[model samples]
Target: MPLPKPPVRRARNKEDNELLIKGMTCALIGAVVLLAPYLAKSASVQDLMRQAYLVGWFALILGCAFLGRYALRRLAAHRSAPRG
Candidate 1:
């Protein structure tokens, strides 16, 4: 008699999902900050926004990095799975 194959587990990783959510949030915040300057009419507010432009860039880059990491992890997991 042939042996039975083990069942595959499709458990989801909470941490990975959280990371994805965080990334999305950061990206949204960064976008808002970057665009706020264009919408502001006051010179003072525009100046402040311009000064904080670097912060927006940082947040955007960080968010992209997190997203990239999540994607890489998922890809690695998929590649490591046993073939049927």
Candidate 2:
């Protein structure tokens, strides 16, 4: 048997704006997490470069955790919204 296609619904302006805001916030947070260590440092060019490299991985892990928590919160909020 073949699977059926799901129907598509257009979003209202408010919904679109909400999604846009969420996307922007996520991007901003991702950028900040990726830049945090360099933003914290006072060092020579070589040391900064080294720090940058190490911080990339550190920030990636941190960002993953942050994003996970963010998504989990959103999911919980979604579940709680209409039933209350």
Off by over 4 Å in 1: 1-12
* Native-to-model Cα distance after best TM-score fit, residue 3 in candidate 2, in Å: 43
Error of 1 at 17 (Å): 0.6
TM-score of each: 0.76, 0.38
lDDT of 2 by residue, 1-84 (tens): 866654443453345446545655655655665565566555665465555554555555555565566566567757855442
Model 2 whole-model lDDT (C-alpha atoms): 0.56
Q: Which RMSD values do the candidates have, in order?
A: 2.8, 10.2
Q: Judged by lDDT, which candidate is best? A: 1
Task: Please report, in order, the local distance difference test score of every candidate based on alpha carbons.
Answer: 0.84, 0.56
State the lDDT of candidate 1 residue by residue for 1-84, as single tens digits. Answer: 978875654345776787799889888878878988999999999989989998999888888888988898789879987797
